[model samples]
Target chain A: MAGDRFPVEATHIMMFARSVADDNQIYYDEDYAKTTEVGHIIAPPTFVQSSAQFNPNYFLRPKVGQPWFGSGKEPTGVKRDAGGGGGGGGGGLHAEQHYEYHRHPKPGDVLTVTVRPGKTWEKEGKRSGKLVFSETITEYRDQNGELVVTARGVGVRTERPVDQK
Target chain B: MALKASQLKVGDTYTECLVEDLKRTQLVMYAGTSGDYNPLHTDEIFTTKVAGYPSVFAHGMLTMGMTGRMLTNYVGDGRLTKYGVRFTSQVWPGDTLHSTATVESVEDGIVNLKVETRNQNDAVVLSGYAAARVDS
Candidate 1:
């Protein structure tokens, strides 16, 4: 069974940070952070993304059932043969990432991250007739569980064409 | 009122200073800290031959971190409302990063800043905007 996702404590954020780097005083220095407009410490722009480490079951799903994925542990789905036959063979690759933040995350701010899949479709290319693209969305919240940041990332999945070697 | 773009007149700039870490040790430290193992940043052969870079380089976030530090140091901590940037160019080791900010506009207590980072080569390594609310 999967464990329930908990609110991200302030200390958790600091722990993931590389503290020896003096450049990160904003996250570690409460006195320094109080002087800023947000009036508290703030996480780096990519802080939200770096804050959480997801289990492989969630991340490695797209690569399963494809030859390029090399024997993953997930249960196999139907594979489509590229030649319009019965065999399905393909894999996934990271395509792009985008982030939007409403405010700087600070100490004492409890965070909850929710992740889900987005668009999925297939298209034909000059060389390949049908290729698929999948998108995923990750949303973050603050102590009161307020929405603060949203990230959407895309991945590309390709299946070999039926006629191609 | 939210920070307005119309408040800042063109050409308002603030200069920020950064101490140089010329030994390349800081770059190595940043690599270890950030967990970014791109060879173009840490490997000499990969950087020189594959990436065509002159030498190892700092992580993009290292420069971004320096810029954020500059903002907090300038406006005082907790004053920044939102800070963001788009990585534009590469910064090699031995490159000194200089962070700069300019008032783009202010409205409804919000101040918009045009921020940039320059290397010792005087080339902009990253450029973008930031927003924050000033005391009412």
Candidate 2:
């Protein structure tokens, strides 16, 4: 998933930090942040994942006037064939995520994101059945076209729900 | 404060309580902010009935984000150059998480760390590594 303009904002950062239960002043208080070595408010390390908010086609988000997979009356809004895995309701699980930061993003910086398919593989699992994994590499560049963050994400589709241990 | 290479050792470790009794509301907050509205994370009816899960679980990114808090707290703001993780297990509501970052090496004004997060059950939920600039 990618977006053309992922505008970094202070409020969004604050909310994101709160969701993770991080009370770091650097994420919210600008006055306190100025005393730090970075001397500015900085987004959390995983904040870039919020760019999904800007991705127009992000499947996880329910589009306006479109059918969502979440429950409404009969448990789900969308119908699926029995045992037909991999389409909606998250379809798969997040297997891994990696990030390389060229520099921490600050508010007012507009980022452009691009994504490319990486690799696909398969493995047998004990809890789940066969696992199919796919990778995507995303690049976030600043308005000046400088590469800011390189993110690699892997998603896995299992033949069945992972058997809880 | 930033970590100093001179004061650091290969085996030094830093730990933090990432979360205590993680609430489902926190998961909803994360899903709202991160734009990952996947039902498996917030819809119990859909997750349990449609998805066949025992209940809705926390998103992997949420655990990673909490773990990132621990890393940045240890290494300092804007210090991390690289961070990565593999989601080893599912995190459920009411699960308390603790994270640790162990100094793996100090070289050329940089520190490499091995990171791990575990639930109250002592199960590893996330495993990863991080690298950051350290003051010499």
Assess each prediction's global lDDT (C-alpha) against the native.
Answer: 0.55, 0.92
TM-score, candidate 1, chain B alone: 0.79
Q: For model 2, how does the per-residue alpha-carbon lDDT over A1-165 read when each residue is reduced to its tens digit? A: 545699999999999999888999999999999999999999999999999999888888887998877888878787784322333333599999999999999999999999999999999999988999999999999999999999999999988888886
TM-score of 1: 0.59
User: What are the runs in model 2 whose C-alpha is more than 4 Å off?
Assistant: A1-3, A81-90
Looking only at chain B, model 2 earns a TM-score of 0.99
Comparing only chain B with the true structure, the TM-scores of all models are: 0.79, 0.99
Top DockQ prediction, candidate number: 2
The residue pairs that clash in candidate 2, if any, are none
Task: List the lowest-lDDT window of 10 residues for candidate 1 chain A.
Answer: A68-77
Name the TM-score of chain A in model 2: 0.92
Candidate DockQ values, in order, are 0.11, 0.75
Q: How accurate is candidate 1 locally (lDDT)?
A: 0.55
DockQ computed for model 1 against the true two-chain complex using alpha carbons: 0.11
